[model samples]
Target: MTTDPRTLIWSKSSYSGNGGSCVEWAPAQTTTGIVPVRDSKNPDGPVLSVPTRSFAEFIAGVKSGAFFAA
Candidate 1:
């Protein structure tokens, strides 16, 4: 059974459109414990589904500047 990703409502990230660092996420459908992420640049591209816990960790890291360049 294949699921259509278009049916999912995506929201633009806060960092979107800033220095080409944009990302979109499907949070409403994340009730299933998996978060869907796709490039804001290419909506028709393949999606990356990460576990909710992992997504949270990644977000926390972003907030904490864990992935920021020195």
Candidate 2:
């Protein structure tokens, strides 16, 4: 990660709540074949870059509630 960063226009996920369950992604970055994800409260922190395909899968899992165990 460089101190001089690349541009990222992050948009919060719809699932985010006011209690601070926030997750943001850059749709523009994903168009370049990489997805940048970071905490909405920590914009200057580390960013996780994922392939577009993997990002889609992760989103699908989230919508399907696969991350929450019964």
TM-score of each: 0.87, 0.81
lDDT of 2 by residue, 1-70 (tens): 2222247567999988886768888887766788888888787887888889999999999888889845
Candidate 1 deviation (Cα RMSD): 2.0
TM-score (C-alpha, index-matched) for candidate 1:
0.87
lDDT of 2: 0.78
What are the clashing pairs of model 2?
A: none
By lDDT, the best candidate is 1
Candidate 2 residue runs with Cα over 4 Å from true position: 1-6
Q: Give the lDDT of residue 48 in candidate 1.
A: 90
User: What is the lDDT of every predicted structure here?
Assistant: 0.85, 0.78
Clashes of each: 0, 0
